[model samples]
Target: MSQRLRLLSVLASSLLLSACVSSPKKPAPVEDRNPQPARTAAPASAPVPPAPTAPEPKPAPGAENAGKPGYYTVKPGDALIRIALDNGQSWRDVAKWNNLENPNRIEVGQVLRVVPPGVDAAAVAARPIASAPRAEARPLDAKPAAASASAASSAAVTAAKEPAVKDKDKDSAADDDTLAWGWPVANPVTAGFDEQRNKGLDFAGKPGDAVLAVADGRVVYAGSGLRGYGNLVIIKHNNTYLTAYAHNRAMLVEQDQVVRKGQRIAEMGSTESDTVKLHFEVRKLGKPVDPAKLLPAR
Candidate 1:
């Protein structure tokens, strides 16, 4: 019995020792390894940048010279010869006036002096405006003796008043005083001058009818270079006036040739028009005037 008791005690002591060795220990308090994320809300997404702005556009070609005096802004497709023709100036004179080394090298948007250097915008504006001649109405029962006396007194008064007429009249006289204007064509009244539509007179005739010059002048332009004026002839009647004959079947005059009033310069045709016709234009300072007003009464 004693031996059995000693063996049981030794087994119980070994079991207790094994339990103490295998039991888990309390873990050391764990430290927080990572910090908390930022509390503030993420900044609002960057503002979307505005779209790039467009640049301003440029103005029309000749808009810069609108209403400007004596200065003509160059337009696209404008040739020096055509410019001179429209302005009633000699191309060489214009070239020299502008100091252009090359007449053919004119640039768009360039301002050109169409008149002489001494002649300014005021002079250009002072040019004459041609109008139809006015007739005075006589009293139906007036006596011839009374009329004669009235005429004599009226003449005396007119001489005193003549000096103070608008400067335009004097300017016109300066240009047309020596020119004895004659009718360009005998046939009349197919179409008349309209500032908006027709710039001059048009007469219907056969394809080879004679086209005459209305006044003495030098031919500055005689060719088909001007558009809408096929086979055109331009005459520089004087410093202030020019005449254009267009739609000709043939041009008889040449550039720099002087022509007299009633001289046949071209043969009428429908070069640019629909039917056979003569298109006559009278220009003062590059602006067209009514030929009927300037032409002598038929």
Candidate 2:
């Protein structure tokens, strides 16, 4: 009984030592053969869209705006270059608008159309006139405040040097007695007067077209008495002027018939030439003057 007790005590001491020396550990959980995927940062936000823009409005037709196409009458002593420069146009544009073969050949009393910059006729006419700059000639003293006093004084001196304006009515009446001439017909001049050929100005027209008197005059002759002219009408305008319309289809006025300017005295016909044309002549004291020089510029 004593031997059995010694063995039991030894076993109990071994168990207590084992329990104190180490603890039982659980087995690790089964691991996945494939590794977990790495995480990625989110993409940057999309750029903001731009704002929408509005379209410009178009002008209406036939409105008179600041920049508009307009017409100007050519006065005496106006050349094409001068007209173009004055109207802010190019010589080429003037020539093209007038259908002029020669840019330098412009006559007085002709009307020229000027177009504004950067704008066409439709746009210009549609624009308002109040928006346009005033074209009147300004006084020299009304210059910018920043201008020097000497500059203003110079401008004043320049203004003082300009010639005084003359009354146009008085000038016209004074020039009236000088025997002004007019176009004999309402047609275009096809051929010009030539001194060497003795051919007078030729007007383009049909037979029986009325030929009018250039100025107030009394008919001196109305017959084909002169050679080379099939039918003729002659008028004595004044002491210095005697005008004739030859190659007429018929004479309307008799000898000594008083006719005013633009009065019809005969009809146009081709009596001398095959083509239908009026042979117009202007004589200064029995001498032939260039019909072109006597006729009013169109």
Candidate 3:
């Protein structure tokens, strides 16, 4: 019984020593292998885009006037006649240069050519135009042809009523005494009218000699704008007659003024002539006719 008591004490001591020793740690929980990604902040706002623009237009073809010379801008109160007078050109020629459909109709701000396209101003004015061939002079005291269409028409009617066998000399003498006719000046004629050499008659006179209108008419132009006719005066006797008195020292009448037959209209001088003379011309429809054809015999 003593031996059994010794063995039980030893076993009790061993168990106490084992209890005082360290206790077993619990197994660690299984850990996850992968981790979640971190969250990011959102942007405040989106950037603004740019605006679109419009495209440009193109020009049309052949819009410019080509091969033409310098032009003149028309002004108010301007007429083709006045412009032609100022520029030393004929109104008809000016119309031809500008391709004008209506000579009397031109608007302000319209462009016109002052000079001709190919011809020069001085050249055009100096060029002589030929007239019909006729005897230069008839009898010095012979009666002239009718000066105007109206006069000619009346003469025709009178001629028609007269018998074909009537004496021409007697009728001519009577007509010369009845028609309104007068001289342009008191001086002797230095040069007679010739179609080739002279376009009109030249009358020799002292400086400041009175130049008279041969018939009743209205002044159409009174200026020195024409190169060959210095201080010229143009008279419109009727729709079919126009008379020019050139190379005058002074003009006594203005354009559009009325004057009776034998009225003094200018003073004779050597403005563009060789001497102190009156250069007289008669134009029918712009073509020069012999003044002797319309002037009464001296």
Number of the top lDDT candidate: 1
If ranked by lDDT, best first, what sequence of candidates would result? 1, 3, 2
What is the TM-score of each predicted model, taking all chains together?
Answer: 0.59, 0.40, 0.44
Report the Cα lDDT for candidate 1.
Answer: 0.68
> For model 3, where is the 10-residue window of minimal lDDT?
165-174
All models: lDDT? Answer: 0.68, 0.59, 0.61
Top-TM-score structure, candidate number: 1
- Answer with 1 or 3, whichever has the higher TM-score: 1
Estimate, for each residue in 167-233, the C-alpha lDDT of model 1 and write its tens digit. 2111223346666788888876799888777889989898667788888777776666555666678
Ranking by TM-score: 1, 3, 2
Instruction: Look at candidate 1 and give me any clashing residue pairs.
Output: none
Tens digit of per-residue lDDT, candidate 3, span 1-298: 9899999999999998887686666789998798788888987888888786767744222124322333445556566654543343445556778887767677766666656576553443422223323222112122222124443454345335432232211111123234465788978988997767777889988876778888866676676644556667877665345578988876666655666678777777777667788988876544577877777787
Which regions of candidate 2 fall more than 4 Å away from where they truly are?
1-177
Please report how far candidate 2 places residue 241 from its true position, in Å: 0.8
RMSD of each: 17.4, 21.6, 18.8
CA deviation > 4 Å runs, candidate 1: 1-68, 77-82, 101-105, 126-174
